[model samples]
Target: MKEVVFQASLDGNCLFLNPAWETITGYSVAESQGRQLLDFVREDDRPCIQTYLEQVKTGKQSSDHPVIRLSHKMGSFRFVEIFVWQTLNKHQQVNGLSGTLIDITDRRQAEAALRESEERFRQIADNMEEMFWIRDLRERKFLYINSAYEAFSGLSPQPLFSDENAFLDFVFEPDRDTVLRVFQEVEQSLSYQFRARHRDGSWRWLRVRAFSIQEGGSPSRRIGISADITSILEREQILEVSLKKEQELNALKSQFIATASHEFKTPLTAISSSVELVRYYLNREPQTPFTAVLTKHLNAISDRTTGLDELIMDTLTLSKLDEGKIQVCFQEVDLVALVEQVIVANFTNREDSRQVAVSVLGDPVWVTIDVKLMSHVLTNLLSNAFKFSSTNPGLVIEFSEHAVRLVVTDQGIGIPEKDRAYLFGKFFRASNVHQIKGTGLGLAICKEYVELMQGYLGVDSTEGIGTMFTITFEK
Candidate 1:
């Protein structure tokens, strides 16, 4: 009877009777003896209490572990584990049941919290992109792997616990030795990088970081993470290749410029000597037909000299652009009149006069620009167009108010698509255009000048369909 007092019962009419029950509920025996037990059971706990009592009355045992409710006098809830067992009469007939209740509120709450923490950690590991792994160094096998590893490798690492070499087999052939060496060093180190072959037959750069876990009397274990660094590795390779190519291109440009300068000097000296001879003859000429012939030769010499001068100037401009020496000064000017003047200056030759026709479009309006550089740009484009279109008569030049455009369209021969990329590169000539007399510096110089003046220059051409060189200067 004394042990039975540790349990409590409320009959159909709700009466709490027992010294131990009073002690557990923080109520005097007198206060609980005739009061409804529902008064002690929290409202939220009444349903479970009723269900449990009903189960006991139906010859069923109350196996529910524990529940919580406030004590009447203590004013705080306490956990109680309730267990019911049937008692027998002396004659071995059926009898009412008795129950044992123990306090377990604190222990149950701790267990629930631990479960929630574990679930949260699992969710984090599963959703992460980086491969996470844990291994027992003593056993030399994987103990755990995150979902990311399984997806990345195409094979779950969980089975690798029995075969320590499984991970080694997945390393790329070129990086296998390095990875093995790194692993050997990891016993003393904590991190390394290597390449691993992915399931898609490509390789990924992987950075691995690990720490050793020491357990008392047991071998040390290792926890590691592997991150994919393929994009970083690719960018590094691309940068290296680009740097090497730029160096080679720079060297090539220097050599080409040196050769072009030497080539231009010879032509320039011949033209200068021819000009001096013409001046000497003109000083004593009696205006004879022979004098006119000499004058024509002098004009030819002058044209050749002008061509050589332009070539030299183009080379010098490109060199300056390469060295970042050119500066632009923006000012308002009549772009239409500027284009007309450049065309007149460049169209002086009989061949140019007979072959190309010049035209203007739109109203003449003042526009902001660097006049000197813009004139150079327009002259180069018109000269190139006329030079290429020498066989085709009536090549036209066009202009507008809001924009100053020069179209030097040639019908002689056209550029190929593959050669377009190198069109603006110094000393680069299309395969078809190589036969045409040119230093190939004209367009490159034009690009630099146009860009310096904040204008746009481009070309359009097709094989056998002729070519059009266009320059649009901002107003």
Candidate 2:
């Protein structure tokens, strides 16, 4: 049998030598003789070599896993992992040691690159706003979820993914079946829109896209991203409502143009006939009996024409207000005088004008307002009061200070509570008050005028008792 060769040394400088080492370093046995082992090691690895030598000198089992760069035969460094063990003398004294070197540079580089790739993936998942998730399809459990999912859902992914049924429970009831169906069709496609409950108890529209990970000819994993689309949904709803309002306004404008043309023509025709009669009759003989009657009929025509003119002016004012084109000039004006003028203009025919008492209270002072608008406001209120209170002859209009108050108290049938809310709305008439003829725009126009003057207008009524329309202006 051939004898096996071994390398051993007592001095640390001439540590271990082997035929394999000489072959690897391109040094013959004779050339390596008497050379310090440190001389053959790479300069940067000398310290680690010394440490391992010290451990062997103490007769201890030195750790073999030493990451060192060693000199190759071509004078270049070779990265190696070394495992060393100590040899002991018969008397338990330290002698020498043996070690095995394995080149591991390629394996180390691959491991380092893999670690960097994983770190990059982690950073992206943490920073994304969209919720990201991965699930083990075979186990029917979530394997990972990004931070955004926890923020939106008010729950961490751990418990949700731990139990297969937990994720199904969190899905909105209406969307559960759809989600399941889409998930089952993962082999075909894995993208869908669905609603999910948010942390704030609101629902969010989410677009989810996913793909299946196949293993061994079967789907084993799934990955997806979920994005919130709540704002998009809200914008769509707003656009829908705005479009509906624009259509309604267009229809209203068409009807208004037709009604206004007819209303104006009727008054103009009456005025024209009266003017023609006046011109013809004035040329007739004096003291004629028909003169007084014709004159009286002409005056009646003038009054009706004036009333129609006022109605047209009111409608124009309302249109300007709607278009935000009316410029109000507010100033201090006497509330008492304003109310008195409205009463006289609307009720000059009252035979018992003295019977209607007008009381001025508070500072009897002036309030900031636009007088023209305020006059229209008072006219609407007083006209409504007179129309509703012809049976109750003693109608009272009152005024006060801190606010200019007008109480058009009547003994007429009052408005019901249910109808009060819509009283100030355009074209609204009380159910009981419909028997009387009106444009149904008086109170609504009154409200707009009052509000433009920075005042409030309202009505209080009880069916069968009486109705009181009140206007209050800030002093």
1-475 per-residue lDDT for model 2 (tens digits) = 1111234475644444556665455666567667776676788889987787677667564435677776877876656666666667899765776556666667778989999998999899979999988888777877888899888888767877667556655578899999878865647346788888898988788888888888898888888899998898789899999989986895587458548856786868778676767757675758577877777777777766765665566566567667677888998887777767766776676775532456655456667889888887766665666677655423233444345666667767788889988988766788987667576677888888888888788788888877877777655
Question: What CA root-mean-square deviation does each model show from the true structure?
Answer: 12.8, 19.6
Per-model tally of clashing residue pairs: 0, 3
Q: 335, model 1: CA deviation in Å?
A: 1.6
What lDDT does each candidate get?
A: 0.71, 0.72
- lDDT comparing candidate 2 with the true structure: 0.72
**Candidate 1, backbone clash total:** 0
Cα shift from native, residue 201, model 2 (Å): 25
Off by over 4 Å in 2: 1-227, 230-263, 266-272, 275-314, 349-356, 391-404
Would you list the clashing residue pairs of candidate 1?
none
- Where does model 1 exceed 4 Å of error? 1-271, 278-311, 349-352, 355-364, 390-406, 473-475
